[model samples]
Target chain A: AQSVAQPEDQVNVAEGNPLTVKCTYSVSGNPYLFWYVQYPNRGLQFLLKYITGDNLVKGSYGFEAEFNKSQTSFHLKKPSALVSDSALYFCAVRDRYYGNNRLAFGKGNQVVVIP
Target chain B: DAGITQSPRYKITETGRQVTLMCHQTWSHSYMFWYRQDLGHGLRLIYYSAAADITDKGEVPDGYVVSRSKTENFPLTLESATRSQTSVYFCASSESSVETQYFGPGTRLLVL
Candidate 1:
């Protein structure tokens, strides 16, 4: 079975502090991972994806994610957290071997940045 | 102004009432998808279309019907609305089978 797991339901951080949101995935073959963010009353926005190549992938809104094949983990990270970065985050995965194009999303994580 | 859009930003309907949600994209993408977002369930797929006439069910397709008569338009219909069906419906489009999906501002529905 292909699936993604977000271990934390909510994470709190102080402004200007570094933050990390953990994600793990299970798949039969190479996994295509993606991160998305949703602000209040807004649709999800694409954050970044790891298909191949570099282990560290950068994305919009000063966010980045690191893909670890050995651990099957793709964790979203930011150097310094901002109050505006507080929102709901989702981790998703797709098995390349299946080639079905459907994604498996984990129950989202809520991040709160306290100023 | 090339992006995905969903009609009826907010809707309120009674039980057993039929409702339709419309989705349109200007990018002419080959793939379109519909998903519902709830409080704790995250986002669940309802249906998708590979092209103008090829449609398929997703993870949670029950109580939902979808038709894609054209490449740019995909409409979802609910034969009988229920309280459990109340959610934020989002429409997304992707250029190909494995690509980044662009989402539209979702439509929030409340069933009483």
Candidate 2:
């Protein structure tokens, strides 16, 4: 079964410092990876996605993710972190071969940006 | 003005009572989905509708019922609500399978 794993339960970083949230996925065929961020009491907001080409994908709010095929990883990164960036991050995977179209999500990682 | 919306932003119900969470999307996307967010579980899909009158089960579908009589509405009903059913439910829609999904504000349900 296709699944995503977020190893870190929490990540604390200083404001203006680079931030990295790790994510790894397992799928039967090509992996369709996505990154989402959620604020308190709010629904998830899409950050980025990796479908086919270009390992590095950019998304909203100065977020970017790199898709690694060999390692089956799609890690979210940002050049500089902000206090507002502190939120819950989720990594999701979708199987490209089958038509089920259900997304498998990771447990999620809470990011804290210390000002 | 054009986005997804969910009804009853917050709800509380007794166990074994039937509760329905409403979801509406103005984008008229071809795909609609229901998911529950828990503390340990990021998000587990409950049901999804490809189009009007076309519905399918997702990862976790038991104890829930859904109907897509119209293209814009996808409501999820818990036949018999349980204490474990307390969760934050989200409704999302996408133009197609590979398209980016847009989510609503979400409805928080608490089963006592």
Q: What is the C-alpha lDDT of each candidate?
A: 0.93, 0.93
Q: List pairs with backbone clashes in candidate 2.
A: none
For residues A42-70, write the lDDT of model 1, one tens digit per residue. Answer: 98899999999999999998999999999
Q: Which window of 10 residues has the lowest lDDT sum in candidate 1 chain B?
A: B1-10
DockQ of each: 0.82, 0.82
In model 2 chain B, where is the ten-residue run with the lowest total lDDT?
Answer: B1-10
Model 2 residue A9 distance off true place after TM-score fit, in angstroms = 0.6
lDDT of 2: 0.93
TM-score of each: 0.98, 0.98
Residue lDDT tens for model 1, B8-49: 999999999999999999999999999999888888889999
| lDDT of candidate 2 over B1-112, digit per residue (tens) | 2499998899999999999999999988999999999998889999999999999999999999999999999999999999999999999999988877888889999999
Tell me how far the alpha carbon of residue B79 in candidate 2 is from the true structure, in angstroms, after superposition: 1.1
Model 1: how far is B101 from its true place, Å?
A: 0.6
